[model samples]
Target: MALQRVLAVDDEPFNLEIIEEILEDLDFELRTAASGPECLDMLEEFNPQVILLDVSMPKMNGYEVCRAIKSNPDTSHIVVMFVSARGSVEERMEGYSVGAEDYIVKPFGQGELTAKLLKLGHMLLEKDILEQQVEDATTTAFSAMATSSEMGQIVNYIENIANIDDVTTLAKALINCMSNFGLSCNIEFRINDEQFHHATSGMCSPIVLELFEILKSKGRLHEFTSRILVNFDYISVLVLNMPEGDSEKHGRIRDHICFIVSVTEQQLLAILTRNELCQQQQNLNGAIAMISSKFKGLMLLLDNNRKQNEAVFKGLQEQFEQRIPTMGLDEDQELFIYNKVDNAIQKSVAREEALIQVRAAFSEIESDLTALSNKVDEK
Candidate 1:
């Protein structure tokens, strides 16, 4: 929808008059309130997409009024921008703490207010789209992690998380735990810069993921009316409907959710560690196979070299014996030559013996590697 409807709440009539003059020619259908209480009284009748709330008003300050508006499920979705003279970081931060979406200091330009409202108007439209998408998600069919004692259910989850071998199962278990407490939640489990999300309304919507990014940094617990967000380091769970109008139940639910998310974070960490180890084991096994194959190739090369040496030396010795007497040497000279030739052949035989020993050493080392691989598997 266009940025048409707006309610400007300020005690000073002059300030309200200035807002009127600025917006007189603009497209905004503006209304003014003299006090915080009056602004709230007009909220339902005006039903504005935006509320330009004054920071300092008699009886009700902007923060308190904004808190009231935000705490109410009916008006929580309306965008609130604090209009105040003080635009310090501290002032803006205070506004945000009360769930104000934007701020405008005193003496803001017509262009500045218009631009900010337009920007927030676009935000509201986007929020509507996201909400619709969330509504459209398939509802999850899951058996709640049922138990009478909330602590007992948590204990069961702690025990069951270990058995959840994958991200999907872990997400489901967490969702089931939330369902047991009568809370509908969307959860994100992040590790190693990867995100795994689940919703009680089926797979997590992109909108829910967007919310995870937006509210995850707003401390451990962020509440906007009935919606509760419990954020931890690696896990964020957004409860869709925290029981409204029940302070005690709300407090208990928040505590339960906080603990559950904490536990889920630990479990997610463990799952990541296990996955990393399994991958490492797989890589190690591949490396071992390659090394073993190379070792066998080296052994084969050694055997081939030994055979070639034997063949070459045997051929030379046979030729030497056959051609020796043709030189017309004496029998004694021939004997001397025979002994020398025998000694030289002995050298080749000794080399072969040394090669056989090297092969035996390679075999021993290969066996050792195999044993080590087995031990790794056992461990």
Candidate 2:
């Protein structure tokens, strides 16, 4: 890895040289600027990790310089420390007010300044490592979900699961997945004056719910996700739900679980249509088999009235073509059809006397994804 870059900006040549000597032993790529303009120019090309700025410059002082650095999105996250002879409590407050992270007074020992810089550098390195881990984990999750058919189908409708028209089987599948991960969760979706609730195993604590409530009612706030962590565990949260808004990094965390929610009513409708189509196809298959069997003998028996029989058969064919459009099934409809077909299968396989046998098969495959969503929301 490249060495962490440090920038020291002061108008006085003597002060800049002294700072270079002080930090000579540290593992950093040190750069210096003799004036405020030179600092800004160097910032454009140097991209330092931290900047030590002098507040007593002749023209643009440290406060003004810090403001310029913080205002620019590219350099805002860079640590800025104000160096000056002013060490009073009021001066420290003023320095911080203008975006200075730390204030250092002149006539200080070289060891104290070097130690502080080392600590700050380590914190930045740690934050960078955490960000990389998060990116890696996100990539792994998407890859796993993409390849697993069962997980893929369920994840396909993840955003729409809450509003799906037929949620029974899909909900069951979601719950099963959560159980596999050892998470207990509940879902509470509200619209206008109405509220809907679903739970698998454990209910989220009141505090967690309240955090969500505040987020919803007050809109996005600073450090929103960090505030939520106070009430929920890091491993437990998969996605932190937010109201529809621009994506923002609300806070830093060791294990950050962030969600991006962008839902519309049209998407919900499409899922419902898909579900209906899956159910219809299943029904049509069964109906065709039964009708074909019942008519096989009758067709043979009508050999004598061939002309009349031919007309009747043509009419039936036309009716079937005119009514069924052959459009695809949506996710919600697919689940509904799958459930209806499955229930029919279970019924044919065994009577109420053998209910446990049929249910055992279902228990093997079905899961509860909403519970996972709830766990993520709780966090």
Candidate 3:
């Protein structure tokens, strides 16, 4: 197999020699450029996996070179590193601002450069495979005809499907365009739990299907859709997946995936919460029954005690009249019995009010629970 390519750009011969010497033992094909323009020219013929650029160059600095490389679609995906004698944090940040993968100080060891290159090489390989697949699938050789009514219709179709909630509709529209415009690929799609689901039709071989399953298990709300587009010749698309490091640029990628993952997680949490609410409703029902039963027993006991006391009070006058005279009691004793009767009536009234409040609270809890049950069912 051919070795991975590395492009080293520096104005100083000694620095270039040092870089070359550091990688002399490594197993890659090394290419050297003395300036930014020369590096860009070499890129046309030499597709290097990584570009190690010196920051302080004469005509075009490392930042400018990085900017140029990134602006061009052909070299944008290539990994770039800026090397400099001025290793201040500000300089490093500037290098990164221009799309450099890493910033290396001039006095760096061979192991450090080698390690960085290895990591960047793997990432470049993955990006290349993905970009190639997308390019091949999108490329077409049809004639460029003048704009017509059909163009307007196609634009309208794209606009309408662009914002639609249904992924299936959008996927179908995309496939229809491919078919009508003599483009490659057929699309088939569905909606799984409010998110889009899709697969390239006529290319669902075991490997492709397995890829779909892996993505599905990964779940919906993905920042962007993972798609496979086969050509008119039914050739399968191969996209490479690269794992990311903890860098800000990497975070952007993670942020996208996280947004989708959160959507799925939110949906799942809603489902679980609904189930929990249902269980709570069941528990609430049992509690209400117990409260009602206990309150009814208490009310019955209060009523029985009230009736017996009423009977005693009614017969109290005769008993007092007979016993007070026999025991030589006065009218003051009769006054005391009336006072005791008033106190008992006041206490009974307070107990009745408390029972009413308890009943009211039970009704409120029942109403709220019913509302929650409806919400769960709607979900």
Candidate 2 on 253-345: residue-level lDDT in tens? 211222211222233345556666666655655655565555544444443345454455557556544644454766687567556655654
> What TM-score does model 2 achieve against the real structure?
0.39
Q: Name the Cα RMSD for model 2.
A: 29.3
Clash number for candidate 2: 18
- Please give the distance, in angstroms, between residue 39's alpha carbon in candidate 1 and its true position after superposition: 50
Global lDDT scores for all candidate models: 0.85, 0.60, 0.63
For candidate 3, the C-alpha RMSD (Å) to the true structure equals 21.7
Model 1: number of clashes? 0
The segments of candidate 2 whose C-alpha lies over 4 angstroms from its true place after superposition are 1-3, 137-379
Candidate 3 lDDT over residue span 93-193, tens digit each: 88888898887887899899888887777777777788787776554211112224335545565455535443344455554544443333423232233
- lDDT ranking of the models: 1, 3, 2
Model 3 has a clash total of 1
Q: Which ranking of candidates, highest TM-score first?
A: 1, 2, 3
**TM per candidate:** 0.57, 0.39, 0.36
Worst 10 residues of 3 by lDDT: 231-240
Best candidate, lDDT-wise? Answer: 1
lDDT of 1 at 357: 92
